[model samples]
Target: MKVLVTGAAGFIGFYVSKVLLNKGHDVVGLDNINGYYDVNLKYARLHELGINKEAASNYNNVCKSTYSSHFTFVKMNLEDRSELPKLFETETFDVVCNLAAQAGVRYSLENPETYVDSNMVGFLNILECCRNYGVKHLVYASSSSVYGLNKKIPFSTDDAVDHPISLYAATKKSNELMAYTYSHLFKFPTTGLRFFTVYGPWGRPDMAMFLFTDAILKNQSIKVFNHGNMERDFTYIDDIVEGVVRIIEKPTTERVQNNELYKLYNIGNNNSVKLLDFIKEIETNLKMEAKKDMLPMQPGDVERTWANVDALIKDYGYRPNTSIKEGVKRFIDWFKMYYT
Candidate 1:
């Protein structure tokens, strides 16, 4: 199938695109390559996908990948009203995996407008294009952050996510609503995967795994939020990609809830690891102790997140079995190589 994967230069996006290409699917990747973290890292990811930095520097035009002829990438943003619609009309994609968004719980506190433009407005454009261009399946990236202050131990899709602490989570929840509207009205299948704390090789620099490794290697203090009281279902990147690929192939034909061809699942490791234990895994991998800075939990942060992926397991046989120790070791090895 021909697929258009937005945010293809992103951490998850990059890995997803590579997997799709390996499966012999024709993939057209799109990303604005914003300076949210490091543009160089984004470029490096694209480079690994066989997209030359020089060819991908331009917008609108598609750049073919040297690694796989089935893969191509476009330097474009979802908010580009004119260009985005034109691409949809031209490419006529069968499946669209919308992974692009301004991602960060804490950063949303600083730059709220970026969330509005990318997450909300940008998502609107995607829905419009999918509706108008006759796209079949629309799989989008939501977050576990939508669970917010819910007291639920293991978050299930049936649980109400009416309260979102941060602007970032609000926008992601809004995306689910918008996609549902499209799915109900246009009769197109849309699935929203609420991802957990995903970590692996080529992970985002802003993420905990990367930050902890970088700080430890640089001899800097790693901030232990909530005074070392936290838990996260840190899913491996490969598991996430596998779940996404399976979901993409199986679009919801039967209406599950609200009489819409829409479904939502928690794509995460069922086991929630403690924050300090996670940090200890990093230290163990590096063979060095970290200078710890035990601090109060920042706003828009949750104390714990545990995903009940039983729905995913029941339907798709999705099982995330990567342990924190093994995941951290893989991430640290990549970090050391990439940095030095």
Candidate 2:
């Protein structure tokens, strides 16, 4: 099947796209390659996929640049409605994995408009393309943060997500709602995956794992948010990609005509780990003690998050296997090699 993967330069996007390529699917990747973090990391991810900075310097989308035959990439912002539709029309995708968005909770507080433009406006454009192009399955990334300030131990899809503390979480929740509306109106099969704290090799710098690793390596104090009281379901990147593959291959069937095939699942380890414990794992792996600056929780930050991925397991047999200690070790090892 011909698959379209948005945010192909991103951590999850790169891993997922590689999986698709390995499976022998024709994939057209799209990403703006913004300087949200280090632009070099994005380019590095692209380079791993056979695209270089030279080919991805401007906004023009590059096609078939990789030595591998099955994958291609385009440099385009999803919010650019005009060009987005054109690309979708030309590609005529069978499956589209929409992972593109303005990520980071703290960043959302600083730049709320970006969340609106990319998460809301950009996602709307993707939905329009999926509907118009007759795409079979649209698997999107929804965040565990969408559970918001709910006082729940294990966040479930059945739980109400009305109180989003951060603009980022609100946008993710909004994506699920918009997808539901599109699925109802156009009868498109849309699956929204509520990703927990995904951490592993090639993870984003804005995320905790990378930040802590970098800080520890530099012998700087890592801010232990919520005074080290926070807990997160730090899932491995491989597990997240596995769930995505399972759903994309098996597009849900709408029970009746004129209705869309729509479902949502929480993809995570289903187990939460403390911030301090997570830090310890990183510190141990790197053989360096972390200078911890324990601090109160910032705005848009949650006390804890644990995903109840029972629905995922039931429907798609989603199994997340990487433990926090093991996952952190893998990341630290990669960080040492990549940086050195």
Candidate 3:
């Protein structure tokens, strides 16, 4: 199947594209390569996929990957209404995995418009393109942050996600709603995966794993948020990619005669690890003690997040089994190799 993977240069998007290409699927990757984080890291990810940094920087130009005959990437924005439709019209993709968005919850607090432009407006364009073209399945990236302020032990799809603390979370929640509407009206399958704290090799620099590793190696103090009283379901990238690939391959089937095939699942490890314990894993991996700065909880931050991936397990046999220790070790190895 020919697939269009939005945010193909992103952390999860990069891995998902590589896996799909390895499976011999023709993949067209699209990303604006925004400077939300380090553009060099984004370029490095594209390089792994055989896209040259110079070629990938060109706006609206499609660059064929040297790594795989089945993979090609385009430098474009999801919110680009004009060019986005043209791509859709030309490719007529069977499946679209929309993972591109203005990521980072804390960043959203400062730059709210970026979240709206990329997450909300951009998602609407994706839905329109899917509807106009004959796209079969539309799988999108949602966030566990949508389950805001809920005291629920394990965040489930059945739980109410009406109270999103940050604009980023609100946008993610809105994406689920938008996808549902599109699926219901246009009769196409759409699945939203509320990813937990995904970490692994080539992880985002802003994330806890990357930040702690970088600071520890540089002998700088690492900011421990919530005064070392936080927990996260740290799902590994490979596990997250596996769940995505399964959903992309198998579009949800219609239960009723003509019901909308819309499904939502929490794609996570189903286990929450303490922030301090996670930091300890990093320290053990590096064999270096980090200068810890125990800071108060920042706004738009949650105390804990644990996903109940029972639905994912029941339907797709998805189980995120990578332990924090193993995952952090892999990341530290990559970090050392990449940095020095």
Candidate 4:
């Protein structure tokens, strides 16, 4: 199948595109290649997928990766409706996996408009494109942060996520609701995946794993929010990509035994680890202890997040198998090598 993967230069999207290419699927990847963290990292990811620095950084037309003839990339933002439709008209994508978004949970406190434009408005455009282009299946990213300050031990898709602690979470929750509406109205099969704290090699610098590792290696102090009391269901990159590929391969059309096509699931390890323990793993991996700075939890931060991925397992055999210790070691190894 010819698939259009938005945010193809992103952490998850990069791996997902490579997996699709390996599976012999024609993948036309899309990203604006914005300076969110480091454009170099994004380009490096594309480079791994056979897209060189010049091609991935090119902003005009789509570049076919020299790595895989099956993979092509467009440097376009989802908010740009004009250029967006042109790509849709040209590619005529059969499946769409939307992973692009303004993705910092804490940053949303400072720049709410970014979330509004990228997550909300940008998502509307993707839905519009899929609706207009006769796309079969649309799988988009949601977040476990949508659970907010709920005291629930294991947050389930069945749980009410009406109260989101941050604008970022609210936008993700809104994406799920909007997708459901489009699915019902246009018969568009959409799946909203509520991802847990995903970490692994080539991960985002904004993420705790990367932040902690970098701080430790540089001998700088790392802030421990919520005073080391927080817990997260940190799913690994390979597992998250695997779940995504499996879901994309088996479209919602096949899962619909009756008439329902829209589905939402929490994609997580189903194992929550304390922030202190997670830091310890980093220390062990780098063989240096983190310079600790204990602080109160920031606004828009949750004390804990544990995803109940039973719905995902029941529906699509979703299983996340990487332990934080193993995952962090791999990340530290990558971080040292990449930075050096």
Per-candidate TM-scores read 0.97, 0.97, 0.98, 0.98
Off by over 4 Å in 1: 251-260
lDDT of 1 by residue, 1-340 (tens): 9999999999999999998888888999999999989999999999999999988989776899899999989999899999999999988899999999999999999999999999999999999999999898899999999999999889999999999999999999999999998888888889999999999998898999989889998999999999999999999998899999998776555553346588899999998889999998999989999999999999999999999999999889877888887888888888889889
Candidate 3: give the clashing pairs. none
Candidate 4 lDDT, tens digit per residue, 253-288? 565556577888888999989989998888888889
TM-score computed on alpha carbons, candidate 3? 0.98
Name the runs in model 3 displaced over 4 angstroms.
251-260
Error of 2 at 100 (Å): 0.3
* Candidate that would win on lDDT: 3
For model 3, how big is the CA root-mean-square deviation? 1.1
RMSD of 4: 1.1
In model 3, state the lDDT of residue 44: 98
Better of 1 and 3 by TM-score: 3
Alpha carbon lDDT of residue 326, candidate 4?
Answer: 82
User: Cα lDDT for residue 282, model 1?
Assistant: 91
Alpha carbon lDDT of each predicted model: 0.92, 0.88, 0.93, 0.89
Tens-digit lDDT string for candidate 2 (1-340): 9999999999999999999999889988899988899989999988888886787877855767565788889999889988998898887899899999999999998999989999999999999999898888889999998998889789899998998999999999999999999888887788899999999899899999999899988989999877898888989999999999988887466432536467899999989888888888887888889998988889888898998988988877767978887888888889989998
CA lDDT, candidate 2, residue 252:
61
Better of 1 and 2 by lDDT: 1
In angstroms, give how far residue 142 of model 3 lies from its true place: 0.4
- Say which prediction, candidate 1 or candidate 4, comes out ahead on lDDT: 1
